[model samples]
Target: MDSTSGPLSGIVVADLSRVLAGPYGTMLLADMGATVIKIESRQGDDTRAWMPPVLDGKSTYYMSINRNKRSVALDFNDPEDLETARRIIGRADVVVENFKPGSLAKYNLDYATIAATQPEVVYASITGFGTAGGGALPGYDLMVQAISGLMDLTGSPETEGFRSGVAIFDVITGLHTTIGILAALREREHTGRGQLVETNLLSSAQSGLVNQTAGYLLSGSVPERMGNEHPSIYPYEPFPTAQGPLIIAVGNDGQFRRLCNVLGIPGIAADERFCTPPLRSRNRTELRPILVDALSTNDAQSWFDLLTEQNVPAAPINSIAQGIDYAESIGLDPVVRVGPAGEMPGIRHPIGFSRTPARYDLLPPDLDADREHILNWLGAESRLAAQSRA
Candidate 1:
């Protein structure tokens, strides 16, 4: 009857954050069978109303990340609500919030308050910036992308700076928050106490930049916008095919040789201009025409099958829907059904274990879907005035 037995099964996460990053972090925990109770304000999460392409007059953004968790709506400023909120935090194993640095202090819901009240709670704080530095800045995914130079690197090599289509910084920050919370949980077993964990969009973006950050710091040179043309790799960007663009990654000389062979143009590998990775990189212009000559012959999938057969890593670029379908076909079960609402499709937890499988819990709750259940469990309704938020 219970399929939920992941490593985090016993953990209960109090999620006081809204929008993508915080909700995304809680979703990750939810995917792993953690009991995540998501708190909302009296007005509900800002994104709950962010719907134009609504499914049955509900926000898709709310559906996207809030699945597999319980939603509790309360006004943090209300004294009774605050007490109830504090009680939840006091019993929680972890708490995730994305409010501004000191915004929660007035309501006595900040990390300090929680840690002081519940020493064993792993309090996770997610923000646009760190609590200390740049804390006052508005935390938004696009703002972080713009400030962190990711936008500058997007789009073509010409016009203006552009944001990534998705909220990459938010997603990455959420991941970092997840990691921090997990790490603190692991360490709590040793010290028998909790700790404060913090992550933000700016830091996550900078950390994610990897070599891009190192290059600027080491070389005193700002990398210009290169579109999809990779900085160090040659002939690796998407190339034209009969159907559409076929992305190829001839990362090394060996891969280049194999790719050339797959194109039925092994002679190209012998050409001095394309003989070595460095040489090919330097002569991408000369090599581009020849590579395109062979690539343009077939569609992306045809070339994808051929290239894989030749032991070269290649894949046809897939849209979101196609990727999901492919993952499901291979038994990954990428989508899961969570409740409080009905069963809605969502991406399963990325990691799996043979011994400790994650719980396939119900869908994300409608506002206070858990209110009656939670109140009944706590026996608070007899002594407390409460109602469902949905």
Candidate 2:
């Protein structure tokens, strides 16, 4: 696909961030058609070496978030390379970085430094924590999960708190950073000046906690781990069926009524002890066995179909592969082939646009893969500037 066909077609992004959060955000911009130039150190992004899941010796983890971008490696210790890096930032419409706070100040690549000369440039900074007392601490997702109370709310009451299987906070921070960048860009359209857009893992984690945190603040009660059960919702977790586990989510009394009808237990929906949402949630222990026994009458797949047909939210617990297959079976097209030759498999961008669709023309680049092209482009711009001066 042609990059110019995307909504962010004319935008040029300088991506100085590495690893998950930074790269994931920039990849979203690239998906929407920004010309993202990934500036890395000579050693490359730390994720490049993260292995065990490699695609032809390439890091699948790196490829997952670095597609549709060009790579240029520059060492800050080298003055010429530093200058080139600055030039890339100078020419970019948007600059994204995820270094620790103040680390880029010495190199004159911080938002303040860049915004002083190029007030029209949208600068986005992602950090582990904000640039305050927590600035010195490293911002890994696991650490953020523990610090933000997510781990505490994860596992069952008897088990030790567990980290999520994915780097959820990093992903959340990246998404928040992307939204900030887009908002700043929109504001620049009206004001003709850009501002610093900042996001941190801890802050994003707190925001991601959403209702869990809000509930604690309002009621003065700390939430505990429930292991696959939602804190405020009953029948919102997995239940055993004849064949496998099935998830039944009943958000309101209407859904509960529908679910009960589908399970051939319509009378349970009217039971005084489990009538309202609050009552059902409060009396989940008494309600769970009743629902479980009813669900045991059929296989998970059968129950899923019956409940779904009745407009009740239900699903069979699927593995990753099964999930992908399920999405495809429903014509969602969850996977796409990327790379120049379309040989590499990738997850499709989640958003769907009517006028301008996301593109996957480029694959994740090897270290410094596009350095020569980037330098040549920079040189051409310099030549044009000299001519304009002459």
Candidate 3:
């Protein structure tokens, strides 16, 4: 157990989630010091089998988000186990699940069933689409990306559009779910009643599309794939340097001046055709050759250092390793060692609280790792309730 205190120190989360979206959300809550009980089936979360990146024979995919939580395995088909599952939810302050709509009702673990007994339960449900017309659709990140127009907005116009390197929508949906759950919990403080919070990958993808979605909705303009180019910003994509590509995000005219100065071509910043942001974007065809010519004099690393020192908003394209190294060099310790013995290395929690900080006390568990402990705790609670009634 984590000895550190946090804002959610006393909250208990009954986590019936699996895979990325649901589990990822619960992990955030767990990091914030919730007593997150991860309940898995006999085979465990599907991601546990997504291998080739296993550490100590465990799937790194599964390990990525399951830290700081206790694990319990239960079969709802068994009457005793089903009763125990219900009891755990009954005592929980929050429940996170990603089961298909109507599926959990049979197990008597649906929001309605649990809320009937535990009125203040904050029940969070995650889905692929939603509970309505898309109810039957399978909730996978790639499928949602395709159907939600994310794929159409990714990649270059000349190439077949590609899915993001990671399951972005799933992660986004999980974050949305986390926000919804927290909001519902706060609302429960006033109303004395719990509410159902729901998020789906498709809905999250549409919301995450942000400017692209708004462009289509407000202007009747369909946004298409622009590859690495930004539709509204000039020099926002990577440019070839002497040795490699460097990303230069010139957000405004001021940054443009700074960039031109760094390139030893300050005159380009004053040219009327490329002076302002909109002009630069409009006359990118004219501006690109000039910037590329200037940049070709220096390798990407040299330009990165020179431009960054001048606050020109630039960086050389770095791989995942280099990105982490860069973060570390700047004192953003992005990794943490979890578990009682610090046995596993996990990403550091993103948010920082001055007082009630996030905690990482447990490693990712083996299946049913906390079964005996959880069952004993439930048994103790049952006896207490019996005595109170008597």
* lDDT against the true structure, each candidate: 0.82, 0.93, 0.91
The model with the greater lDDT, 2 or 3, is 2
How do all models score by TM-score? Answer: 0.92, 0.98, 0.98
How would you encode candidate 1's per-residue C-alpha lDDT over 49-120 as one tens digit per residue?
888757777888887888768777878878988877877776679989888899999988887877776789
Cα deviation of 323 in candidate 2 (Å)?
Answer: 0.5
lDDT of 3 by residue, 25-91 (tens): 9999999989999999989999999997999898999999999888998899999888888888988
**Over 4 Å off, model 3:** 1-4, 387-390
| Candidate 1 structure, TM-score to reference | 0.92
Q: Give the alpha carbon lDDT tens digit for every residue of 1-390 in model 2.
A: 124689899899999999899999999999999999999999999999999699899889999999999999999989999999999998999999988999999999998889899999999988898999989998899999999999999999899999998999999999999999999999999999999999999999999999999999999989989999998899899999999999998899999999988888899999999999999999999999999999888899999888889999999889999999999999999999897789888999989999999988899999999988899999998899899999
Best lDDT goes to which candidate? Answer: 2
lDDT of 2 at 21: 94
Model 1 has an lDDT value of: 0.82
Model 1, 212: alpha-carbon shift in Å? 1.0
Q: CA shift at 107, candidate 3, in angstroms?
A: 1.3
